[model samples]
Target: MQDRNVYTIQQLSAFSGLTVRTLRHYDDLGLLPARERNSSGHRLYSRSDLLRLQQIMFYRELDVPLSEIAEIVDDPDFSLTEALERHRKRIGAEISRLQKLIATIDTTLHTVNQETMSDRTNEELLYDGFSKEQIEEINAEVDLTYDPAIVAESRKRAKVMTKKEIEAFKIESSDILNGLIAAFRRGAAADSEETLKWIGRHVDTINRFYTPTPEIISGLGDLYVQDPRFTEYYDKHVDGLAAYVRKGMKAYAESMRT
Candidate 1:
């Protein structure tokens, strides 16, 4: 008689929503080894394996590297209860971020749908989600970092953009940032071809606001890590993301110079 507590690889896949191939890959990586085999040598998973898989999936959802997940879950002192508590905290943070993003989208939609022209200046509409303090802080950083003429030129370009255009630009920027975060999470080398491709896309996105030479791109990368505001923004999405992006951008800038 088949044990109720044990599942075949196929059964486990169906239960976990992981593909057979993925489960096989996990097994090969020694991440989730099957505890028993049938007479025909088919893999069988115990209930404990299912719980381990739950941990793996949770870490994966948080964009943790599989190798890191393995080390974490395999540690002798690992406590599932503590891990669950941490996961809850991380998930709560994500929910708060999503709420803010939703609010930004709602504001943009309201601005876009107005039949009458808004009295708000283009800069006001474009920076809808930022508090006055945040805008001031960002402006101060820009003034500190760049020449006045360059700052004037960038603001001139920004002021000419419509609300819809600004919203679209924000969306595109978010998408590119998410792509870079994903690359960083996957354990890709900072200077790898895949990371460079994302960095190129990021440069293109920035070019819509101001012309960026390789030197400017490299400088922007440095600012991402050096500025507390920029570092907080990127690392909120993924820890160490600002540093990872800086490395990729620096490498891309070097390639461009060469």
Candidate 2:
């Protein structure tokens, strides 16, 4: 007795391009519950469900967490026009960042292809778009808290990477930052599972640049808040992201000790 206007999970998945498992997960999260259930206990969706699913997909594409999406969609005060406007600005900024990264890659590739590749200095080959002075400023910021020799060693390691490796490293760093932002928006605790996941990613990113013992990790956490450069970097993503990252990193370090 399948209703003509109603759709089972499979039908919705086919129409929506979302996997059935994903649709079910949304139902489990109460973010997009089914409109009805059949006699066989199959989940069914209606026209309203289709429209809500479309909205869910739109927010999901923006990297909004399902929990946040639920609130935004369900809130009476939530304005679709405003949400789209906000997404427009954010997506535009992301596009600009990626475009710059692509240009950097192109420059690196051109340098590598030229016979003068061997003659180009490390600064020219590695830190595209950043002048020597800008690079010095960044290194000085790190050296303020850490040993200059250690920072130099880290830079030396990064300088040896090819253009693609550099891009991947940048992407990895962004992913960790975005993960923390997501956790923060969800109101995750300092040591909550969600926050811990981002902390794991942060640790892995640290490992890429340098070996990070628990002590080193904890020290880096302190630097996040104590260093204005890092504080600004993380806080720019969200109001208190730097503080949240510090807490999560410290908690992870403590767990490693136990």
Candidate 3:
């Protein structure tokens, strides 16, 4: 039978699969103090210490900051069972977020590939599942410059779409973005005939879906590079794709009589 009392740092590291350096750092951070030292002066962990480390790791999985987690796990009133329940619920939320994000990527890729869509507005297609406040913040950053009429219509259209329709649209967009990234990797020039064609399609789709005035699309093009959120959204689909899309949109919009 295994002993349940004292454990050398190595034994604790093995059991927890945590690096010795990490444990030492945690000790330095006062998240976990060495329970005792052996006769030769090496650090030793106790059953209590190991259990505490497990609690810390559990919080980390939920993206809780280390400092906050230390305070939480070390609190006498903090219930381990309650913590586990919270963790389970938080995990479910994270999974839901990931699922929505994947769908958004897919829809973006699809729209990029098709090169055409109606003027109902698909700009906020990726905004599903976000809290209302978060959605407002996102729109304020990117969609605020859009035509109010187009924005309202887009919102209405989004509300009417079935869940399956949204999911299908997301996957389609993801495919287009992945393809663009691949082409970009192969040295396709952003303004090259083929590449510009894809970018042009993207602009057209947004205009068609959002019914954004030419000026609205042009304004968005200008903001693409200046706004990190827009840049990151495009970049996530493909490296350096954001700047290229911005350029393409600018060129297409400039061609229009805004």
Candidate 4:
């Protein structure tokens, strides 16, 4: 055993599920600092480095854009104490939300266990996981942040569509999402030409449903930005997703002539 707190970069990478390349990039970006180097010049991690990785992951959870996070985390005045304090508050908020979700799920499961529950409405069976008011509030946030012309265009496409058409379109979207997820799972390079083809298909799906121009299709990247719901969808399916999708979409969109 080397020591109680000291770890090699490869060890830390395995412990944290981060790639060695990503840790190197973080080091290059100055987001994560190395603790020490052994005689052979291998980077080693200390308890401090582990804590720093935690801080970086927290910032990533909120999608703070790694470049900006690098600046904030690297400043001499930057205090891990401050970052941790902020994390505690944010985590407290999430705990409260998760508790509510748990209650809804528990209630639904209880109902599902009962023979008499067959008559319950689907909404009731779902246990009112979110109030209609909450959905309205979310929609309000999206409306406020989404570009108006793009929103109008997206909304117009929806307005012109029949319910059956929308359902059919959603099937296409689901297929595209599953494909993107599978590609990521297979460890495909996010910037590969084949990956860009998948991204172009994704854009086509959005254009079919949302009337997105290549630019607007790219702008819909904001969905992953401004909405935790969207973020959760990606995170549930793939790690490092939102960034990969964003990079791929931008590459694909810029190549498009129409």
Best candidate according to lDDT: 1
Candidate 2 per-residue C-alpha lDDT over 76-180 given as tens digits, one digit per residue, 9 for 90 to 100: 997777877887897887687667768888877777787346655743545555545657887686667666666777788888989998899899888888888
In the range 1-258, model 4's lDDT, one tens digit per residue, is 579889999999999998998898788777787878999999988998898788789898876667778787778899998889999999887787778889888877777686446655845646454656778987897677667776777678778999899898888788878877888877888778768877877777676645555676566565564566677678655556876777777667677754
lDDT of 3 by residue, 1-258 (tens): 435688988888999988787789888889999977877998888887987898888876544557898889878898878877887898888798889888878887888898654555777775655668776787686455655777688778788889887787777676667666776767777656666666655665564366655576567777877776667677644436777766666666666663
Q: In model 2, what lDDT does residue 44 have?
A: 87
Clash totals for all models, in order?
A: 0, 0, 21, 0
| Candidate 3, superposed: residue stretches over 4 Å from native | 1-6, 14-18, 60-67, 129-131, 135-258
TM-score of 4: 0.61
Candidate 2 error regions (>4 Å): 1-5, 85-150, 160-211, 218-258
| RMSD value for candidate 4 | 6.3
User: Which stretch of 10 consecutive residues in model 4 shows the poorest summed lDDT?
Assistant: 122-131
Against the true structure, candidate 2 reaches a TM-score of 0.51
- Best candidate per TM-score, number? 4
Residue 105, candidate 2: alpha-carbon lDDT: 81
The candidate with the higher lDDT, 2 or 4, is 2
| Weakest ten-residue segment in model 3 by summed lDDT | 199-208
Model 1: pairs clashing at backbone N, Cα or C within 3 Å: none
